[model samples]
Target: MADTFHDTDALVAALSDADLDRPPALVANAHITGVSVARALSAHDVPVIALDRTDSGVAPPSDAVDYAGQVTYPLDDADGFRADVERIAGALAFEPVAFACMDEWVRGFAETEPAGVRLPFSDLAGVERVLDKANLYALCEELGVPYPETYEVGETDADEIVERLAFPFVVKPAHKRKFEEAFGTNVIEVEDRGEFEDVVAEAEEYGATVLAQERVNVAVGADTSLASYVPPESADRDPLAVVGNAAVRYPEFGSSCLVERVEEPAVREHALTVLEETGYHGISESEFVYDADREEYVLLDVNTRPWKWISMPVAAGANLPMAAYADAVAEEEYEAEAATDGPRDGRWVYLPDYVRRCLTDEAFWDVLSEDDWRSLFSGEFEREGELTTGLYRPSDPAPAVRYLTGEFTDREYYCSC
Candidate 1:
């Protein structure tokens, strides 16, 4: 049973047009993503209930999760997902915002939207557009967005592929979710032809339909992403999440851990082009890396769901998750904090995780200035903006502690996989 709250009427009134009282948010999946979504919404006084496929792998969900109640549903079972969401939403008498954290969950919710439930995602076609990497790259090509030179290797002789592409290229599957789940990595970088062949063979053995792409030069430390919250009916195209400078502390070469709010016009324009061209409306992540050789940001991948470190934007003055929530429940064209032409700079970090990486990596140690350390640890880390965090929160400290716990347990997760 869902927890009884006195503010149910107010929560229901905000989430949907229905008259019945219910929780305002239905967060599916209970991993880091779900925890983040639940916490973000809760900050806005939105009541949230959590659901899960299993509890063994992820439990003791951050205290923010299960704020309303924690229910179990077979997320893999699409029919079950729709049924469960329908039942829960009906109880509250209004459609709650579906976090829809995973690709499967997003697809499920989008395909069969329970009555009165609002989901923070793109349309079905738009969801498929970004979920399939090959399709996404193809769309970018059509729209003239700069993506790395990508080659689909379909039974072509490995020697031929080796002849065309230089060494240190990446080998990844067309579909990212299944591939990552199976191998625990997004892509593998091979240094030589021999390594490439071996990697492809191993990938194929694990059901990977591989692509060989030129590795964008990141020697300048310019890994960037332009995240945005696109309202479905809004004519305004300003980005809610800007390309605030982002940095990584784990895996050495990995996803961002800390983000600074700043604008990269060319990078931002390229990503906005793709979204507008696709008529995509939702939270989307357009990844790019600075190509020092090309002197431009080269596109990498497009993510439909929230990216790691998304909370950075909220700290930097753009609360995207909330923007999407407000958009979902708005009765009309409501003005929300989507974006501004000016700069909103800030940093969001997981201090312990970063400290662990810095202490262990010689390369990391070489770049850390004394002032940077002092500022970060001394609570004076502002660089004309502000600094948020990955996990630590005084109001709700469990998620931060839980993430750092799991992050250390699987330290190499951010490293070369």
Candidate 2:
């Protein structure tokens, strides 16, 4: 039974009930990403329980997800979150497989591996190393992976940075979440020396350690993401990889709004290398921008959890969340379906953001190739293997309705974390 519980006593009672057949999948937040994970696992007949900080009336109620209402916020109160997690875990009939969708949730679960649950991400230290861009860049350098050329803000002099690098570089935080907290966006594009210095000073005023990175002239239609799952070491199985090309993004260099499932071997290779180097075992999405000048793909960022377009992989015949869950539960070797000639040639669209960008941004039109433009107004939504939306599914229609009614109208639905 997928029951919503407002009190711990009721929640514990429901979970502890012996009649509950299978061990439920505990999802951290009920945001779009978490909802997608829940749906992915439910397709395999796994029960899903979504634990959020509060109901808040924002997240759409889904048949695929049962709410664990008003839990302690993982980022705000780590101790309380740990206690709550343990309390919930102790009531379960079997060890629940936990999936954390946000950075804070990942950190919370990693730091406190509460009893009676299976975590899918790396440990605290390993996850932190990847979350911090400075540390990630260092690791990329050590492993000979190509990332954007970067200059440290505090350590390097402002004048020297301007002198060394060309104009129109970017200023971003070493720690992305901290900066995003201070400012709404993660990056600031500096057009010249003056703007570069100004942005750096502004970031310092907010006590954020920023970095200067060369603006990679990304090739059109070359922004790619590799969604993968690395099983635990005991499973000893090959990782499952699915490559997605971001045809368009919103808010100028933000998350993918429209993606095309494609095969890019080099992008997959670089991402797997990093995951192997760190011993990261879980669902991950590694982003890359193709540098046409260098004829290479430059690694941009890595997400250790289910990404914004995670549902795309399930549509493409590679279910990452299910693969992780199976490996975590079974002792036998798990051989995932190879990334192959399935329904991989399709488009995944975050409908709200894609439509918003298309209507508002003039530059959004310039990014679209001839075929992309044709497909934009094609008005074909029902064709199988043609398109998969981020939220809308025939069987699960409430979430999409909620999104379009409330969040989409208010313009506060940028949950691309």
Candidate 3:
């Protein structure tokens, strides 16, 4: 095993020099998430090798060190998918650390690859448990964690669903990806039997099985997650370390649009317990819904890959990407103390939210007083730099330029069902 690289400065210097012979290969999926990872690695001077399916002829950043050829696929074919993985994996040497950007891509890679590849994190079963809504809820039950009251309703047993479950429940597809097209919504909160049947009929169009879960009357807000990496051997053990985390603030009462950090101990304890019970390894984020009414936390779901708010915790202090890289390449075990308590005053507002606040309302003014406005706008706010920001600095701005120009508009690569 190679000696672990501990010094962030040395790692950055070696990566940027362009003279160093060995550079870590980053497998990017051409999604914004993947591009974010690629940019972060690049900022650290690490070489990135991006791969994507070219349905629209879109390419990754031109400044990328080495851009591999595209892997195309039909919308329906399943068998041909393995060929794509084999092609991607074949290009790399032994034990190349892979960063999966999309859920299906990660599933495909895990299912098709040999054990020689150091995936090291979540296995096939763990990924399925985390991604499948029904399975995730079941895991929560087994762990004795609080969750939304849920029951699976197959097509044949649709009539019995209402009889078994209460009214005003949410009907979601068993699969997360099919939520938008099949149900026409990520979740449908039905008030009565009539609405439930209507939703089931709509779901039939996408050929999806549904799960009806009782909507916890708690205030609808985004969930908080703890990001951590569990080793292959410690898959059944407690988390090796918590890298970082983010909390999404929901828009209205549905999905999370705004995200921030929360250092609550109760949220962390429940998240760790859920992860350990599921035997999850790799980079996983366990989510918890804080019920302000009950003054307690409920386990929501776990994400097996870097989520949309992956950069949030990076702004906080625990860098999951760097930890993942270190775990993948290093010989020694890496452990860092879990951050349970800290000053919770700082806020990292998302760019979209900030824009919305500026254009739509006086919300910005209320949040930032006259004195606070100068420091916040001046870039003096302590920002936990993103992984991509660390990799792609101002000295070499080509990657940043290409990234911002929409050269990598191939969204399909990272959003597979």
Candidate 4:
């Protein structure tokens, strides 16, 4: 039978009741999601066994924990992955719960592990559809959901691309972190044909095709998101859980800045419709741009994994990690409910960069109306804590410090920005 915990204290109490002789295995240990979940588990005195590609230098604060390093990759080599799973599983005495944080790692374990290790993903084909942007956009188009206009430029001439996509567009790699060293920007805006050609030329060094897309200027007003977890069987009904719902604001009309949370039912309905039509199960976040000209919201992009601001929703009550764990273990029939009742306005400001942008950028004033300016300065708005800040408490700063000081060599195990 599965152990149940009603609240944080009850969860901790249940952890205190666990048999430390056999601890749960946290796969992809170096990942922030793994680290956050491990820390939360540790608070409950649950024994944790961390398994990843590297040692990550820092160990769990709890003495009841152990670390095992294993090199595993997702590829066509089924034998190699199965062997690694066997080794890791044997090392932990065949731990029942294996928390998967990385996509490739998750797929590998899901494909190779025995039935005892529970994974919260659909079949391999389902994973592929969600991970690939091209596939996702194609699915969205078929479902009559709105998506940014995208054109792939593999080896085509620059003039041809410009002719097709026109100037004042965006050129981004299919995945943001593929060319981090070369481009230094996730999404690049091209004002004219000259800038577009220059950016495309630079993108070629990364061995990726440049995707020119229409620039949706939703950053001018507010960029909001609706995140949820759906089940494979119930795509037609409500989601299994609503994990996150928040809005963000930029300092300038054109600058990329911090985000916040604001409640809007219209935004939620649009996001939910897209998720359902796409058959997107697991954690999905849909971004929307409020266009003032049309007085409507336009879909920007869809993230198939946990978001950077995951902690905000946890503070607001929908703990995605816990919900995902529950769903993975089949402890309860998943149910979705609106977490945020009314329109609660809040903002998460990136203090250092937000200050700098406001001082230097003239377009900053275009983003905020007179009322927003008054509310911001008056401190009437609620501010969510930074996601990266409180992962390690003062009592335990080893993990956070190690992560910052380059002590961890397993960078791939963690989510790449």
TM-scores, all models, native as reference: 0.80, 0.86, 0.73, 0.65
Runs off by more than 4 Å, candidate 2: 1-9, 56-60, 192-207, 331-343, 361-383, 408-417
**Model 4 lDDT at residue 225:** 74
lDDT of 2 by residue, 2-51 (tens): 44546655677666763546667888777788778888887777778777
Q: Single out the weakest 10-residue window by summed lDDT for candidate 4.
A: 1-10
Model 4, 284-317: lDDT tens per residue?
6677676665567666666665544544454444
Please name the candidate that would achieve the greatest lDDT relative to the true structure.
2
lDDT of 4 at 327: 56
Q: Which wins on lDDT, candidate 1 or candidate 2? A: 2
TM-score of 3: 0.73
lDDT of each: 0.65, 0.76, 0.54, 0.53
Put the candidates in lDDT order, highest first. Answer: 2, 1, 3, 4
lDDT of 2: 0.76
Candidate 1 lDDT = 0.65
lDDT of 3 by residue, 1-417 (tens): 011221323323333433333335545455445655554455455556555554221225434334443443323343555554444444444345677766656765666654334564676777776778777778778877778767887733756777767677788777766667664456788999888888877777777778887666564444566766665553234443332333323233423334556566766777677766676667777776666656666766677876655545554545466556656666645443234563223234444343455565543333434544444445434332212222233444443444444445643223421
User: Candidate 3 — what's its lDDT?
Assistant: 0.54
Give the Å error, residue 257, model 1: 2.2
Residue-pair clash count for candidate 1: 7
Q: Which 10 successive residues of model 1 have the least lDDT summed? A: 1-10
Best by TM-score: 2
Off by over 4 Å in 4: 1-31, 39-48, 55-82, 93-116, 154-161, 174-210, 234-237, 240-259, 292-294, 331-397, 400-417
